[model samples]
Target: MSTGIPNVSPNLNLETKDLKTAPGVSLNENQSTVLRSILDLFAGKPSLPKLALWRDDATFTDPITVAQGRDRYAAQWYGLQQAFSEIERLHHEVTDAGNPILMDLKTRYVIKGINKEQTINSVVAVHLDSEGKVQKVEDKWDGKLPEGSIQNVSSLLDFARPMWWINYYIAWAFWIWSFAWETKKKMTADITAQAFRHLNAVTVPKLVSVPKNEEEDAKKGN
Candidate 1:
């Protein structure tokens, strides 16, 4: 899924046949298929095939926006295509985490109009529902200009140079924000689980029936 950030690299279209699965990762048949489809989608394949893997109420989240619904997720691609001149995947590492598959990617690309090139290291976590359709996706990344690139600060005069400082600040802010949000989200989930555990641990007293004529029964027995 696209991050909805302007001037960012267009998403790649990776082929299943081209990917080499990481060592010691075991994936079920369904998960393997989904993983392949996800790679293809990122490589810039037609949206229809990618969308088919997602549920109608699927959500895509990144630093910029939390897009809910398949339609919104699909729209981000259009913006990305218009913003970047070309996108290339440099390296990738895939991890199979059962229901939620994780992919770490390094990518490089050139922005349109300005011809500025950038590299990004990003991780995408995709969650699949019980039916094997994508339910949610979380994307996180850090971007930088490659060393010795024309866009490097030393290449341009101070006044004409790109305001890289601003970009640095923004990236840092996003990192902190994402960290805090994830922390809070995990904490909340933990608290909820603890609450349920406490509730389940509570002991209930069993009821005992009282005999109305205990004395009479004892006398009759005697």
Candidate 2:
């Protein structure tokens, strides 16, 4: 059975046959066949090692920072992997959306995670080298709360529960607001229907009511 675990560079062995084809405006049949073979080898393979080789030590190229060293690339790769794992979890959820994910349109990843009404959104930027290896991966985090909700309480809450009173309060507050908004909408619709019914019931004669008093005699002076 193929283990779902990502094949890290330490275990994967790259062969010359695994090299990617040269991208261009056009390629002859010979090139196409060679490229196909190369693609078949590299397409599904992990390229973590290639990414480790290209990272700049001083720059925070990814969401997490890594120190400069012989092993710095490995450290950076691990950081990126962590971020990617987080994103994977998010994409598993279906309720959240609108995540931006790409420098080139060719590669894209979107993530959305929902716990009750709370949602976590993340956009990941990824780059691939000519060898079809992962060159870079970056991540940004976003928290989306229900309407009229504050961040204080929501931020304190754990994955499943919050020890803070404010978290509970906010949860209840959102629930009430959501309920009230729906109730108000329904009430408005009902009231409008009732008003329409009353208007429909009024006849032409009823609408033309006789004047009660005022100038009763002056108006008839003719």
Candidate 3:
């Protein structure tokens, strides 16, 4: 059952601001649970500020310092909490129905004050692990504004924010995404076909050891 992957403890000193540390990023049960709690807390309310680690240097270390445990976790949690401040709901759907490579389309509602809403769309490529956990998560976004959407919602906001092509980045992003996708599809199809041809040559034959008698078969069954 072992994957033969060495258990190299991750550097705990990563800036904690620019990334999300999903719980169970490591295989260790205790570490995984604690990481999950931190992720859950930030995802749930995001307002809770102080984060703490229950272990000391004997339990956790990256090389340089010893006092960087709970504080590091707290910093990362805060960053994640801030990153999603503008979003309300994130929706995802699969594109390739038969494949695990999901076409995640996300529609985020931009928060307008306390209750108002604006729409921003995004796409992502997601890959899951054998355990049904997210093995990889890649975010895609267009910095451009939606076509005509900005014009439609123009009256809602103050006149200070001018119409820049920067608003058009979202639309441009979608265009770029389509192009990239088509190229990937062609390249992947070609690579897969080539790989399939090697399957027969590279596969090892199975060696089945048959039971010698009914008693042995019964023992094996047991």
Count of backbone clashes, every candidate in sequence: 6, 0, 9
User: Residue 13 lDDT in model 1?
Assistant: 32
lDDT of 1 by residue, 29-117 (tens): 55665666666555544344445667779976554344566555654433344345777778777766565788777777566665666
TM-scores of the candidates in the order shown: 0.54, 0.24, 0.25
Candidate 1: lDDT over CA atoms?
Answer: 0.50
Which scores greater on lDDT, model 1 or model 2? 1
Ranked candidates (TM-score, high to low): 1, 3, 2
Which residue runs does candidate 2 get wrong by more than 4 Å? 1-60, 66-70, 76-88, 92-120, 143-222
In candidate 2, how many clashes are counted?
A: 0
Candidate 1 residue pairs in backbone clash:
12-42, 12-43, 12-44, 13-43, 13-44, 14-43
How far is each candidate from the true structure, as Cα RMSD in Å? Answer: 25.7, 29.6, 24.1
So what's the TM-score on candidate 1?
A: 0.54
Model 2: colliding residue pairs? none
Using alpha carbons, what is the TM-score of model 2?
0.24
